[model samples]
Target chain A: MEFNFPPGLILVLGAIALPFLKGKIQQALIVLLPVMTLVLVWWIPNDYTLVLSFLDYQLSPVNSTPTGRLFASIFCIMTFAGGIYAMGQAKILELTAAYVYAGSAIGVTFCGDLISLFIFWEIMALGSTMVLWAAGSQSAYRASFRYLMIHLLGGVVLMAGIILHVHTTGSTDFTAMQPDNLASILILVGFLVNAGAPPLSAWIADAYPEASPSGMVFLSAFTTKTAVYALLVGFPGATILIYIGLYMVFYGIIYALLENDMRRILAYSIVNQVGFMVCAIGIGTELALNGAAAHAFAHIIYKALLLMSAGSVLMMTGKRKCTDLGGLFQSMPQTAINGIIGALAISSFPFTSGFVTKSLETAAAASQGMVAVWFLLIAASAGVFLHAGIKFPWFVFFQKDSGQRPPDPPGNMRFSMWGFSFLCIAIGLFPGPLYRLLPYPVEYQPYTASHLVTQFQLLLFAGFAFFVMLPLMKRTLTISLDFDWFYRRFLHIFAKEFTVKTSNTHIRIEHAIHQRIERFIKRLYRHHGPHGILARTWPSGGMVLWVAIMLAGILLTSALL
Target chain B: MISDQDKHWFYRSSSLPKLWMIQVFILVIALVPEFVLHHHPHFQENGVLVDATFGFTAWYGFLSCAAMVIAAKILGIFLKRKDSYYDE
Candidate 1:
């Protein structure tokens, strides 16, 4: 049977009914929608394009390719897992927004035209903003506004780029392009903004942490990963992304190290992880693209898993700061174990999902013999273990006891965490299935003896460094500044100053004009008033004399001619 | 009401040393493979080795992490502000 409509629409349409439904029905739909979407994602045959005639153009609203399928598959799985996790505690609004968010992300992957891609891109933005808004805190509300401003700005830029690109190239296909013109550069900037790249990288850490525990799990999965997918497809082999990606990687590490909020730390690491994918996309080889895609898939599962663990703690304990949490393993044993598994996976420990998937990118880099890039990637790998891999679990679940023993999150959340944890190990142990889904043929192995040994040495020693540097790594009640500060503080102050100064200058100018006009009017009154020289009653004789002179002059001129 | 006395075995002061010892043992075990296994260098060119020095990954990992921690600390002096920095 052929399914023509975009599969993501299933979730998008289904989610609309959620707020109206109650109890078992809503719950059932929550689980059922993603499953149906997944089935439909597969049911759509390869290379199938559902085209619609719009004006002078053909739009492929639904296009199926291996890369799109890979991303769509993960989006479906994430929605499913996130649904289960959020089922118990998330408000109806959050659940609804998240589903829409997930669906649109899927829609973006399957887009065959720039216009269709853009439409889905916008919906994803609105959906994610709504999800953040549903957290229902003052911070969440405020942060949602900031998040919206940035995304809308990005969307405008993207739209402008698309218009220019289509006008220049006279084609609307969402295929790869060289960054040789204004339009393509704008598009790349637009994609980078969503990928948590620099100058705006602070958005991930600033906004994602403000979400409700479950809200964050959903937030962690979609926006940036979708951006990665877009970049992988749209701007492959763009070398500039490598430097940008590396900046994000270290930026994530440094900031996460200083972060006090557990969720914020994870939020920063999302930037870090996306940095890896962005870097690999910059590499732009088939293997690098494959690695970027595979890493994104693995990243979503483990990142969600990590956030789930953090979220569980947030929900049960009513605290999010690392300084406020410790020794939670006793009460939340399953959560801690799952959290550790996620940490290990993120660190790319042997026999975990990250190790297998991440190696593909590095292998690509190594093959190219880009020595500096390779070394930096290796260093960043170690940095990942330090900040997210060890620091997250160590401080949150171990460290000094804060005397809070919150029990494991309720059944559904636990179920979701275990499910993802299982996938992390399962994929790590058997990468063949995942590798086959890559856009390119799989020609790499991850478990060679040298590879295994080096990975252990790198991670273990990084772990050792963490212990040695424990004194400096103490959590504090502070936040490190990022580019958001420009808008959050600097632009705010600038706007205030601008308004204040402009209004003051306006008043001064008005007063000066008023005074000048009053003076001019006074001078006019003095000269032209009834008692003044020009207003005197002798005007009749003067008028008669002037008239006679004018008549005489005219007669003389006529006679001379 | 759980008390400090009810601490998990993993966190117990007695077990802390044991955990440390285990960590040290694993670190040793990880290095043992460096001697036993033939190393393949990924960043070599022609005949010159760029990255596969003896215990390179191990030391590099340790030093890089330490550098990051210190760098964060130094940067904290300039960038760190109270959690309520934005609220006001």
Candidate 2:
């Protein structure tokens, strides 16, 4: 089976035409493009491949594995839902960029060669940066620059790795490779950078929230998850990912706990959720990889849903800080309910998408006898409930009334939420369809008595702990430092100081040269002054006597010669 | 100051205690499943099944959550700055 045209190109090409067409046609395409892409996503058979020649190498521009299909399916769905949500409010540039962003993410999923994957990868980075920039705020502009820099760095690293790999092995296939060689290691570093892994994990939280509310809904779905898909496909079973994933999980939880901004909290949790996927990919069993893939699918829905609710709040209330939000449930009942559903889904509460999908990873760990890993993952699950599940809804909706009565968002926004809320529960209640979509055969059940009992106990008690320790979790008008501080703050200060110091030294050097020239001029002035012998006019008699003596001496010398 | 007249029932002083009680009751009910349901520990230690202990998930969840919160607090002291810290 083969496709003459790539499925992702529908949205990419459609996005190009979006800005030109206005009103109904634009709106129709906004929704139509993704749905078309989704149909083509599934229309292609599992064995589909479209290999093309690129210079000396054969490039598989379009390939369909079960994992790629699953990811592409969700990418299309997210784009469709995000398109609907953003249509009423987002600027034309934002909508166009977001569609391209979503399209390229789908592009990455179907790519079977490293070169094509890198092409789609860079397009995603560019498109998302444009989406962020379209927010049109000063901070958004600065954040977009920072975001672009990090992604470009990651792209460079990935390209170098691909070149090296192709040069050495003469293969551009983007398949699982051990991180034993420098090329593979560089590739892993590249993927990890985008996964919001450590030392640079701060980029996700730093830039994501800067986008417009609708823009963020699109922003949340693609970038990191594409990296997760990349890791799952290209570096599965690499043990280093396990350690990196653990770091990201905890880093997200800890930072989110201290974060004051609502969207930033969600931003941090993106890193956290991707952390779980990365860890599962590291585990590398069929079930674990399935867990990673399934979790990515489930995560995109819930995370986008979560960000939508936050976006709606940000839109209606004109506020993004938890310190200024509360008791919004009184007026915005629908938004509140949707948010809680999203919260429940993200927390992996029973009968939600997260419950069925995240459990696969835990089960894999247990099955593999990784007791410590299983324990840590369980603890992190509880932590997820604490920070994202309970804290987000609690602070934003149910805490002390801020006396602000912003109604629910506009109709389209609510409709988008309803659609995703339906998916969160639908996938949970009936995971069989989703399970069958996995690359591996389904051998797991999520609704056993033991699993239900344990999950409920864990989540319920986490909820209890949330209230019991409410003081510690109180919202403050403060932001916690993350690794981004090195760039946004520390490096900023360093660069400024370096510039000032260099300019000062530059001035000092110029002044010294000027003084030396002035001194030489002064010395020359003194020697050549009217009072000096050399500067004074000689008397005519004195000059004539001197001339006569010199002439006499020259005549005597000439005669002697 | 919030007038009692405008307060929603959820936040009204009189309804707060009842809400707390309901939460605690549901939490207790969550624990009851441990007694009725047979346990399947994800892992075990040397013939001793640690997860099989009564209310282990409950305690672990609560403790781990509390620990994370406290840990965040400790770290926040050193790391926390005014929201305008970056803007400056």
Candidate 3:
């Protein structure tokens, strides 16, 4: 195959030089780079797969399957929107890291082998961690460390799985893999960890919120979505993910319901949205895969839209908790409006972007006769509406008048929010373009009389429940416990206790050993020192006596023999 | 009684009414696709069941929101803490 300079690489390479530029040049490059990448991705011809030989295996880095291209396109768009939103406020270091993080995500999208994917995956981890640290707060630094540990652990698991998989299959092509072998299952777990699957899901809420306002916007886009892309490519039909996804759906809702931090709530909702995509991937039909892909595309747009609004709020108020903020609609009108659009879209309200995308997955389950899965997904849909769709906007913008009135964000931030909000509606209103971009041919339709009516009832009833349950949903200063509690609190305490106990044991053993050594040394000195027989100036007399005894012993021995 | 400086700031601020209009506009925009463009092909074609599911989501979301508000009101009867209730 002919090698042409890949345009995506050039954009990222250009962005790396952005920090060196001053003021307007830096800002222009920050916005220009992602937009150029998006254009490159959009203009690239379809079905253009590329292969290269590496270490006796073929590496496919330019795989332009429809699914891969669609995800890549949106990731580029996210970078553009996020960069614009962050352009004014973010430090140069953060802006650079964000570009690198976005670039690596795009790189992963183009990778067609596990090795290539792994390389880009780890790049994304490190790059995003840098973004977190660039938040320029002590809490951000600590959180970035915790976040790094989690990703590093995930990277180790993924690398081990890749090694075993290459050994088992004698190939490293990243493709739809079955869980028939231990290696593939390990690979699945590794991807799931990054996907914010349970037990490890705590890392996302713990880390993302601590990031800078703009940093969180970029942070929200790449990592989990990359995992979804990986899952779509490999282990699509794994049935267990259905349940795991359902668990995450509820986990996000319940925790988000209890959360007070505005960004943290949105962070939790990211897991919830990704859970829908994971579930759809598990359903593993053409329609379901389309749903997963479409949802992911739509999710990144709306989720970023949400985070951008929240970022604006945080920027204005210097506060994150819901209780500390209210009546912000009085000050930041544009933000409030854009934020509500984001909320509506996320809730999958009829005719929104989420409405068009999320349904295909649930439909795929029903068509497959997976009754239990279908029911649970329906309930989870309600839960999504309850926690993220309503709770986020209501508390942050519309609840009691907290008497704090901050102005709207800067132009760049508003533009970012507006851009994403526009896409959310455009896609909802014109899903034909999105469906055409799917990996498979477009066939399924979202609207029907019965479909519309029932969806309305479910979401409306869920909204009703939210208001009725407002007492329970009050913003609390106390944090609800989650799986991270195991590592952050319990394990820390256990380690401290173990360290104390082991040190005490070590001291006691050292004392006993020292006493024994001292006693032995003292005995040796007593026997061998100057006052003792062997050390005396009369040692010649002792030597004679020893010789005489030796002669007596020798005579006796000779007689006995 | 409110201070004169506070009154002046409130009178001069563009926050309250502007925020209200923004929120109202957002709600209106959100409802547009639902009420006005509900029959668009994109919404009509993904799947009937999935469409139904979104419909359910709407009802479920509204009910939950309503419940939360009522519950907050009820909890205010006894459990409502001072703004600094949890502070040490």
DockQ score of the complex predicted as candidate 1:
0.73
TM-score winner, 1 or 2: 2
Candidate 3: residue A54 Cα off by (Å): 2.3
Per-candidate TM-score against the hidden true structure: 0.91, 0.94, 0.83
Measured with C-alpha atoms, the lDDT of residue A326 in candidate 2 is: 92
Ranking by lDDT: 1, 2, 3
Per model, how many backbone clashes are there?
0, 0, 73
- The candidate that achieves the highest TM-score relative to the unseen native structure: 2
Residue-by-residue lDDT tens digits, candidate 2, A1-561: 448777888988899999899789889899899999999998988878888998999899789899999999999999989999998799999999998898899999999899999999999999999999999999999999999999999999999999999999999898999999999999998998899998899899899999999999999899999999999999899998888888888998999999989999999999999999999999999999999999999999999999999999999999999999998998899998999999999999999999999999989888888887888899999999998998899899989888899989999999999999999999999999999999999799999988898899999998899999998788889988878888887898999999999999999999999999999988888889776667988899999999999999999999999
Worst lDDT run of 10 residues, candidate 1 chain B, spans B43-52
Best by DockQ: 2
Stretches > 4 Å off in candidate 2:
A515-561, B1-5, B44-48
Q: Enumerate the candidates' DockQ scores in order.
A: 0.73, 0.81, 0.19
The per-model lDDT (C-alpha) reads: 0.93, 0.92, 0.81
Proportion of true contacts reproduced by candidate 3: 0.30
lDDT of 1 by residue, A1-561 (tens): 555699999999999999999999999999999999999999999999888888987799899999999999999999999999999799999999999999999999999999999999999999999999999999999999999999999999999999999998889899998888999999988888899998899999999999999999999999999999999999998999889988989999999999999999999999999999999999999999999999999999999999999999999999999999998988899999999999999999999999999999888888887778888999999999999999999999999888898899899999999999999999999999999999999899898888988999999999999998899887889999999999999999999999999999999999999999999988888889887677878868899999999999999999999
RMSD of each: 6.6, 3.4, 7.3
TM-score of chain A for each candidate?
Answer: 0.91, 0.93, 0.91
Per-residue alpha-carbon lDDT of model 1 for B1-88, expressed as tens digits? 5553676777667787898899999899888876767777775554647467788899999999999999999999999999999998
